[model samples]
Structure formats: structure tokens, C-alpha cells
Target: MLQIYNTLSRSKQGFKPIEPGKVKMYVCGMTVYDFCHIGHARVMIVFDMVVRWLRTSGYEVLYVRNITDIDDKIINRAIENGEPISVLTNRFIDAMHADSDELGLMHPDQEPRATDYISQMQGMIGTLIENELAYQANDGDVNFAVRLLPRYGQLSDKTLDELNAGERVAVADGKRDPLDFVLWKSAKPEKPAGTLWSSPWGKGRPGWHIECSAMSCDILGEHFDIHGGGADLQFPHHENEIAQSEGALYGKDRKDDDAPFVNYWMHNGHIRVNEEKMSKSLGNFFLIRDVLKSFDPEVLRFFMLKAHYRSPINYSDAQLEEARAGLVRLYTALAQPAPKVLETALDPNNPWAQRFAGAMNDDFNTPEAIAVLFDLASEVNRAQGDEKQLLANLLRSLAATLNFLQREPTEFLQAGAKDQAGLTAELIEERIAARVAAKQAKDFAQADLMRKALLEQGIVLEDKPGGLTEWRRA
Candidate 1:
């Protein structure tokens, strides 16, 4: 009963998988020329949330996120680094995995590298050529004929004339039309050695857009349930993907065969800093590894889920600190002494769980769902005895769907910022002991001073009913 916002339809619609109880989804992944930035983080985290919710909703998902290992960027970067294309791509792919692991992203069911599927791409391009949807230009490059596909701009909601007039489409020397995009690029004499592939269109490589069309159809089938990527790709990249995938099917003489390239399209909004887009060219981008130095990985994840997936999230130190503080509150509630919890499965019948599911079902509205988590936390804090234990278990179960709150509350609460030096556990225990001694001596002022000192070091102390004290980092 989950409804998602489909970018193609430009509205929220009920999700119905092509198969009854299974979903086949393809998401455009990183280009892998450099380390992933915060923008890339949003794509990974957003789709991860979607997949987790789908599994929690009891549907089998075949998630395929493709890798662009043989793009122009990769070639140029390898040239600059004075290394082979394979060496450059493999190093960045490993770095990307490390970043994904740190962000708690589940590995896609299939990660097809573009370079590994050259044969399939060539075959698809040949099909388009036979169908007359694609043609080999005078320069030996094969380009998709955009004018032949009447629905070319449907995905981006822009007409061909609009795209052509808004920004002057550079009519490449050999292209017949200005709007036509290359399906295969011909190798140039000045190009690097390993960059070229023996293709039907001469020794060249696949174009940027053709890689996804070939890989997605080959792995997930010509038609799948969902296709996702960043909003920046909505224009030429995804629009061209739809054109090539569908145009290859019924070129020119179009028919309603009830088969489309993809059913639902989902796009995560950009990451902004001070009302400007976060990008390397703007010098405002931060690498995932660099951000993890100051904030916990879980804190960064929490910060992302705080906003709706489609909404742009502004990154700043203040926002991250606020996220850490909010996460501390949730962990604090969980750290309360209670009986052991065994069952963690979500019970949709439970009223709290019902509210949470309702929020999640309505277009994956994470902000609303997160509000339910806060409300549950408040309930857990207010209740007592077995009631508290039951509610705490429910809180953990719900958070697990979002891929967080799995850590022991005390451990997470006591752990300080990753790169900063805070009060150590031993030092904190000593301070607590000194404060206890001061209290026993009736030196209330001395005890209060010790308490303030620990608080200043980002530590919070709680006095239990039986003269026991608990300490956690704030």
C-alpha cells in the first residue's frame, strides 16, 4: 500500500510491482572518477531507505545500481594520474565501497560495471541501427535519432524545441540534428590506449547514456518497476535513457504494447550549501570521508533522513550538530534500565507502528515517519516497568527499518565525536567518583562544580533512585 512520488508522472501514485510480490529496480550509480561527495551520499542513502522499507513491507527486491567505470571522466582522470584506466577505476570503486559501508548502505543485488558489458551495449546499439532509430554518423560515431521518437522529452517534461531553444544545442559536426545524442563514440588518434574498444562503429567506447540503457535492460529486463537517480540526471541522462530503451523496442511506428522502459521514476533532490548547489566546480563540496571525521556516520545518516528525500538538504556544521543532539535524545531514551527485549519485528497492528507505516507509505515521507520515532521515544521515556520495555523494543524495531538504532544505547551515547578529544570513560568515572565523595561529605557546591565540569566536556549525568549515577556524552 506504499505510494511513491514518480518523477515521470510528476505526482504520487500507488506502487504496483510488475511481478506480484517482487520488485526489480535500477538506480544510476556513481561515475567513480573521484571520492563520493555529499550529493552522492544523498542518492545512496535515499535509495537505501527505499529498499529497506520495501523489504520491511514484505516484498522481494532485486536492486541493481550500475557503475560507470569507463566514462570520459575516468579516462581523463587516468591520464592525469598517469595510470591505466583499470587501476584508476578500481581504486575509486574501492573508495566508493568504503564510503557506502561507512554510511550503512546495503550492497545492491547486482552492480554491473559498464566496461564489463561492452558486448551487450554493442548488440543493443546494433538493434537500434537496424530499427533505424540510431545511425552511424559521418564521423563514425553512432547517434540516437531523437526526432524519430515522438515521446523523447516525456521523461523530462520538456519538448525538443524547448530544450533546443533554452540552451543552444551544439550541433556536432557529424550529427544530423542538434538534439541528437551519441550512442557510441569513435576513438580519436589522441585518445588514450586503453580507453578504446573494438566496436562495430570502429575502435571506440560506449557513450555516457547508452551504458545505463544496456546494463539495466540486460540485468533487470527491458522493463522494470523503478528507476532512480539524482535530479540532475532528469534531463539528458535519464531522458535519453528512456528514449534509447523504448525507441529500440518499437522504432518510428510506435504502438501501445503496455511495455515501457521503467514504470516509476524516482529522483532525489540536490544537496545545497547557503542556497547554492554543492559541487566540486563551485568549491563547496565535502567528501564523505572528510565529513565522517567530525560527525558519526549514524549522525550523518540521521541528518539526511531528517528531510524528505525529494527536498534539498542544506549542509553546514550547525545542521550536523543539531542532528547529533537529536540522535543523543533517542539514544538516551533507549539507555534506560529495562528488561531484555526479544521481539523486534514490526507489528503493523500496533497503533504506534500503524502511524509510522502510514507516514512511510505516503511517498516515503521520512520526516513524518521520523516524527513518529520521536513520539515513540517520548512514550518510552514516560512509561515504566514492562510497559517501558515493550515500548523500547518497538522503538528499536522501527529504527531498524531506517538502518539505525541497532547499536547499544549506552555505547552510542558514551562514544564521543569521531575526530575530537572528549572526556574518556575512565576520566568520566573518576569525576563521578569525586562527585559522589563530595556529596557524602555534604559539600553540595563541590559536587555541583564537578557535575558542571563534566557537562562542559559534553557529558550528561543522571542520578538514579538508589544513589546510582549514569553518564553519557551529550
Candidate 2:
């Protein structure tokens, strides 16, 4: 059984879904105003790993990651670029898919876009209003009445008084309370025409918090197995989701018959840059495409899982290089040709497999699980004959759970880094040919010089036994 740390409970707890043998998970996804950054990548990859593990653990998983396509950021970016909102969002949505593909992310079962769920959002807002948990302000904006929900700050572990003292909430125009968040934003005369949707609160769009509440409940019912996002969203975003979702379901007058909104809440830690939070405003954030220019996507993914999901991961060239080397070692073990070992059903009872499961079950402790992989890889390297083949198969089988080490080892090794210093597959091959010619002529000095030159360009050349040489980017 898996024990996940529930953000709401603030402790690790055994995972039990509302339905036996089934899991329905909702994760807050990208707000598509620009290219996804490393932070966004963590969210996508983390949840992907979770879903993979759930299915591997013999449960049917229904994963839904919602896209916030109609947010203020998307609207502003579209206006700035003088394009339609759909045009701006569609471009980034495509970019996001490309990035996810490059990172080897498994697509969620359902990707619900905010624009497509407007009717559901409106209906939920109306329910809140009727329940007196939400009200239309004097300015026509509908806001959640935080004071009415006694457990408003439960998810964040902050009482209303503590939140008020520790953080500053701006008193927006027409809001009854500073802490109250908007459920529906009333349209302004200066706003773009298509940005608004007709609703009981006039022509305006749904607020960010209500979008997830509506979409998750609509798809997964009033309650679900897991709700996850980055730790940054633990405050107002997720806290408000808890308020609205639970408030709508149970109403202001709580009933014993009402079910809890989400059974478990999970959050992955942030990706830091040089020990500081990575952010665009700080000029420290790295775009996924930008990073992929230098490092292999698998290297990036490996770096992410090196640290526990709940722990902060630092991003730097040194860290990525280290991750690259580690990945290369894992691939090197798989490169050796051996007799095919019979594929067998995954046995959790296997000693190494049990260790892997133990680590994974204990709150998805990837670092420890990865250690098990490294240990198995060592056994694969030392053993021979049938024993080695069995170990190799076990290594591959275990790695598949985390979605790693599936590619042919040579393919990964020779794939090299993405375009760097004008190095291309043709250019590297040409250099290799020159080096081979020098060696064939017995011009040892010239051969050594050619090898040195390629090495200087971050390529490592390996001499094989059959007058063959292999090269990979270092």
C-alpha cells in the first residue's frame, strides 16, 4: 500500500480512494500565456510519475490535468500581441504538448480546458450564491464569502486571523472583505469583447479558483481520490479551491451526508535557481525549450527525480551535467549485448523489487527507489550468463515504472546533446572519419590530435575491439 503525504492532513496517510480499485486524480495545469518553465515541468512530470505508479500498483487511474486557457495572463498577452485569445492560447498549448513530449511525459486521460467548462463554472457559482456562500458584490463581481466557511484555511494550515496577520490582502474595489476572493470577475468597459461570458453576475469571466472546482467536480464527481499541484498553490489557489468545492457541495449549513471533496492533497516542491526561487520577475527562470538546447530531455527528467518530490531541487549547469553522467552510466549497463531473458510478470516479492516498492510506497521517495536501480545496475554489470540476463531484465522492468531507461542504450548514448557550438550529427561523423583515417595510416600523432580536438568540443570517443569507435557528447 502507498502512503502519501496529504497536504491537508500534514502527515503521511494510507491512500484509499472513494471507489475501490479506482483512482480519480485532478492536477492544476499550466496557465498558457507563454512557454512552460522548469517549474511547470515539475508539476507535469511529478503527477505523471504518480499516475504511472498508481496504475503499476494495480489500480485503474483516471487522471485529469486542467489547462487554464482563459486566465488574465492569457488575455493580457493576447492583447499585447494583438491576437485573439484563442490564437495565443492555442499556440502555447501546442508548445506545451511539444515540451511534454520531449520530456517523455504521459498525457493525462483528460485535459479539460477552462474555456470549455464555463457553463459548469457558472452553475457552481450559482449554487454557491444560492447557498449564501458566495455573493455578487456592488461592482457586479461575485466573491466567495471566506468568513462563512469555518474550515477555509484548513488546507494551508493557517487560521483566518493568522493569515490576515502574516500576509497582506489588497482591498479590491467593491469587495466586502479583503480576504474574500472573486468567484466571477465583472467585465470592464476597457476589456476585450470576447473575454466576457454572460452570467447571473453580468458579462464577466470565471475566476481562476472556481475553474478547477467546477472542472474537477464535473468530471470526477463531488469527491475524488487526489488533488495535486505545486506547493506555491497551497495558499490562496488551493485553499480557495477547498473552500469553494467543499462549500458548494456541503453548503454553508454543513450536513453529515455531504462527502469530502478530495481524499488526499499532494504538492511538489519548487525548482530553485542558485538557492533562490526560480521566477521570471527575478530573471532566473529557465524555459523548457531553452534548457533542452543544452541538456537531453531525459537528463532534465533525471535531475528532477534525483531529489524527493517534496524537497526543493536546485537548477544549474553543474547539477544538470551530473545528472547527464548518471543517466549515461545507467544506459551504459544496458548497452552490452546479452541473451534475451524471458519477460516475466513483475513480481513485487523479488528482493530488489521489494526495496523499490518500499521506497516508492513511502511517499514516492524517488531518490531511494533510484538507489535501488543503481544497485541493480551494479549487479547487472558484475553478473554473467543467465544471472546477468535476469538482472538486466529486472533493471529494465523496474526502470519502466519511473519511465526511464527504455530507449536502446546506443540510441541514447549516441543521440548526443542538442545543437551546441555548431556541432551536428554530420559534423561529428566527419570528424570520426578523419580520426579513423589517421589511425589506419599509422599516423599516431595525427590520430591523437584529432581525438583531442573532438574531445575539446565535448565529444568522448571510445575505441571498440573491431576497428570501431563510438562517440557521445560528454
TM-score winner among the candidates?
A: 1
Give Cα distance to truth, residue 147, candidate 2, Å: 0.9
Model 1: residues >4 Å from true position, as ranges? 165-170, 338-344, 419-421
Indicate the residue-level lDDT of 388 in model 1: 94
Clashes of 2: 0
Candidate RMSDs in Å, in order, are 1.7, 2.2
Q: What are the per-residue Cα lDDT tens digits for candidate 1 across 48-71?
A: 999999998989999999999998
Candidate 1 CA-lDDT value? 0.89
Q: Write the per-residue lDDT of candidate 2 for residues 113-204, one digit (tens) a residue.
A: 99999999999999998899998888888998898888788898888877782254556778877899999999989789989999977899
How close to the true structure is residue 129 of candidate 2, measured as C-alpha lDDT? 89
Least well predicted 10-residue stretch by lDDT in candidate 2: 337-346
TM-score against truth, every candidate: 0.96, 0.94
How many residue pairs clash in each candidate at the backbone level?
A: 0, 0
C-alpha lDDT values of all predictions: 0.89, 0.88
